[model samples]
Target: MDRFGDGLVFVVALVLIGWWIWRRFDNWLHEPPSSRLRKLAQAGEVEPDEAVDFLQEHGYSVLSGKHRVPLGVIVDDGPVQTTRLYFDYFAAKEDRYYLVRLERSRQPIDWTASGLRERLLPYALLFPECDGIIVADPKDRLLRTVRFRVEDEKA
Candidate 1:
């Protein structure tokens, strides 16, 4: 092969390898919990409804059945850009709101108290109106919560 042809081949191979690595990392990080739920369903271990059952069993009245809430944030362009935040479950019980963040099994479910606190901080900052945040993985049978206390905007 000519030198130019070999160089072109090397560039193409590098691009393909980079693309594969990117896809693998993306899948690892963003594996959907629904796929796990499907596995649970097939195994007859736990049905998808049980996620809500788990929440209800713990005293959270399901306020939203998978809903996206629109939020406005100021970007470099100056005008507020609308962004959507998706939560698996939005529940309220005893006058306090709870936002549930679900994780896939590949993602780390076990976290130190401070680690879990850090994970929920973004939800707290973005959705300050919510009273608390919870992270649950049914496959791992784990649940963690942090009461997110946002200062009143008036202050």
Candidate 2:
């Protein structure tokens, strides 16, 4: 009787494990494709973009340009407003992906810590996989990379 009970338990355990594996496999198979990074990587362009050239000159390899992600914001539980999070260029250096944002004359960047957090932190938070963000000012020839680190504080 004990032998039969052990066999039954073993069979049940196997069935549970198989069910969990199937669930994982099904989710993986039906998961949505990755964002534009894959598509841009696949597209081989003969013509070089100016932004790409700028990045290359600064020692970074440009992967793609004009990357945008659709964003929806709801304020005060009101209707959702659609906008875009625009990335001027995507580049790599030292095997790390960096999202590039070109500085515009009209909307100058605030170099202060608070201003930097308000303006640029969203990009880093949205793509936690990315190493950081590179802000390039072609006119003034400035290239800056920003990274965020969170440390636990002992209270």
Candidate 3:
């Protein structure tokens, strides 16, 4: 009876291990793809425009175009003010993703470091996953990528 009980225990343990393995495999098979992959897969849906052409010329593939992020700001418990932040395009180069901003005559971007921080930093901060911001000045035929790093001040 003792040997029979031991064999039964071993069979139960093997069954449990098999069940666990099957569950893990099933979950992995059904798991959703990463957001980056999803975005890249959807890149084909975007309509190609001048910005896309400009980005492609710079060796970056345009992923998505024209994003408008809505914002609701309340200052000092006052009424909420609604506004929108606009992004010209999303592009990728060598597996790195970047948020593209087109230079406009109406809303020109300041090229200085502080100016860049003021204008482009928000977009970078908002999309922390993006590698950086790509400033595309198609009229000037220029493409620049901007990245930010935080440094601690030593007293």
Candidate 4:
């Protein structure tokens, strides 16, 4: 019966391994792009908060203030909650509002305008009233302003 017990043990081990692999794949599939961006910034390649501050220092007024304050509206005797919004920067003289998002990598050359555009599109939808969005790579001091195109869905 020793052989029979060994076979059963192997089967249980295989099942455990399969479960672990499946869990990892499931997590990877559901991971958000923001998580990847944060990892890049944490590697000492970029400063995301600094970029936001730069925008504010340049005269951009944050709509909901820092740290995304929760604004609620009462409906049906319950609070309707919405996300707190913050602007990266705004230029009052030019009537421009900027949403600054950061991207970073150890190999700065890999960074591209298209990649930045892909990340900022969601923010544009979130802040439809903003004049523009700035995808800033603080490590490289590279900033690209994507003009808000309310007419274009891609923006």
Candidate 5:
């Protein structure tokens, strides 16, 4: 009887593990780029202050790194919900707002899963509100904009 109970427990554990793996895989596929970049910025691998300085030197007036504002729209079964979008740094110059992403090179140098467009499109949706979205690689001393055109928010 003990042997049977152990076998049942093992099978149940295996099923649970498999389910968890599936959920993780789904997240990896659908997780937006902005979220990944935000995580990287928060990881402390690269100093936020350094990135802020870089943006400043390049003519970006850094406003704040984090803030919640009623900015985007989300449609659901219930009702249209206004979602607050997050950016690493919100900046402006000449009365223009831009959502900035500060990426500190943590890995050796690779773009396997994380690509540029995946992250930029979401920020672009803030069109008219924000002039555009810019991504900064402080370690590389490079800055680039993700030009926004109409596109789906998910992959």
Candidate 6:
């Protein structure tokens, strides 16, 4: 009976640890990328317009296109599905279009990259002519350029 009780306690402890790990991961995954960027901007690490103007100054023309696609409903069917649409900065020079997404933050480098690839990549795809995406972190004074095949669908 003592052995069985010890085994049960061990199982319960393992389960609790697993639950805690899962919850931490879920919270990290759902954290907003913009939160970090805002912090960087506030600290004056990088100017928002500087990042935007960098692409334009490089001869990429800005494409003024906005899209609103359904994400999901909030509460019930009564409030229709909605999505917040933002303008994606695009500049076309010659045959290549540069889709630039500016994210300002004073966070860890790895976190910035993870957020950029996960969040901004899809937004850049919305521009059909965009051959590459620039994820610029103003706070770090770092820029990561990601190129996509022309055949890929623009999200």
Best by lDDT: 3
List clashing residue pairs in candidate 4.
55-89, 60-90
TM-scores, each model vs. reference: 0.50, 0.69, 0.71, 0.36, 0.47, 0.41
Better of 2 and 3 by lDDT: 3
Q: Write the per-residue lDDT of candidate 6 for residues 1-155, one digit (tens) a residue.
A: 99999999999999999999999999989986544423322332222466556655555555432224346556754777677644344445665555555664543324455665566556555544455766566445666667644465786
Candidate ordering by lDDT (highest first): 3, 2, 1, 5, 6, 4
What is candidate 5's lDDT per residue for 34-151, written digit by digit as tens? Answer: 5543443343332357888899899987766764446645567666767675567777777666777766556232333245556556566544456677778887899876555565
In terms of TM-score, how similar is model 4 to the real structure? 0.36
- Candidate 4, residues 4-123, lDDT tens digits: the string is 999999999999999999999999999965554333223332234666555556555433222232456677888775655443333322544445544547423234657645656666
For residues 1-155, what per-residue lDDT tens digits would candidate 2 score against the true structure? Answer: 99999999999999999999999999878865444445544444424866667789978988767766789999999999999987777777887778889999999889998888989999988877778999998778788999888768985
Write the number of the candidate with greater lDDT, choosing between 1 and 5: 1
lDDT of 3: 0.83
Q: How far out, in Å, is residue 37 in model 4?
A: 25
lDDT by residue (1-155, candidate 1, tens digit) is 69999999999999999999999999978986444333322332222487878777778776555656578999787999898766677666786666788887666644776776666676777556666788777666777777754468997
Superposition error at 153 for model 5 (Å):
20
lDDT of each: 0.69, 0.81, 0.83, 0.55, 0.67, 0.56
Cα shift from native, residue 25, model 4 (Å): 48
Model 5 clash count equals 0
Best by TM-score: 3
In candidate 6, which residue ranges exceed 4 Å CA deviation?
Answer: 1-49, 63-79, 106-117, 138-141, 148-155
Score candidate 6 by lDDT: 0.56
What TM-score does candidate 2 reach? 0.69
